[model samples]
Target: MEILGLACAAVLLFGAVLSIETRISRSDRQLARVERKLDLLLEHMGLQEHDPRLREVIELLRNGKKLYAIKRYRELTGAGLKEAKEAVERLG
Candidate 1:
């Protein structure tokens, strides 16, 4: 009986952890979807590809010129400008 109770407890704990992980993953996917939608909207508004300034900023970020990239992005996108700048600084 003791072993059975322990096994049941372990199973419940595992299930709870699995549920939380699944929820987190679902939320992450939803957030990604929203981000893609925003990216598309920005594209439609001509904020991507052709915008030399933004393109340059992204290039700098990709090349690890994070600080400069964030500064330029802040000056351009104005999306979470301060946080984005701080994130780049942290990344660097």
Candidate 2:
């Protein structure tokens, strides 16, 4: 019947979608692992990536305005407040 056929089609479509999503989830996990390894490698090499705009944050930090430094870092990097504050602390 047409109803049965439509049900089968819907089930196939849903299975396809689930398969694609599972593949994507697996890929994401793999990418995260690779990135973590790369971060560790970079840390072991004692090399840090430099951003020119970090200078502005450093200046604000040196001026004793910690909150302003965090705000500037967040603005420059589009980072969250906690991340920006941690970065400012590391830089100082």
- Compare the candidates by TM-score and give the number of the best one: 2
Clashes of each: 0, 0
> In angstroms, how far off is 81's CA in candidate 1?
22
**Predictions in order: lDDT:** 0.72, 0.83
The per-prediction CA RMSD against the true structure, in angstroms, equals 9.0, 4.8
Task: Give the per-residue Cα lDDT of candidate 1 at 35.
Answer: 72
Model 2 lDDT-worst window of ten: 31-40
**Stretch of 10 with least lDDT, candidate 1:** 83-92
lDDT of 1 by residue, 1-92 (tens): 99999999999999999999999999967876797687678768877435555667767878988877887777776646655675445334
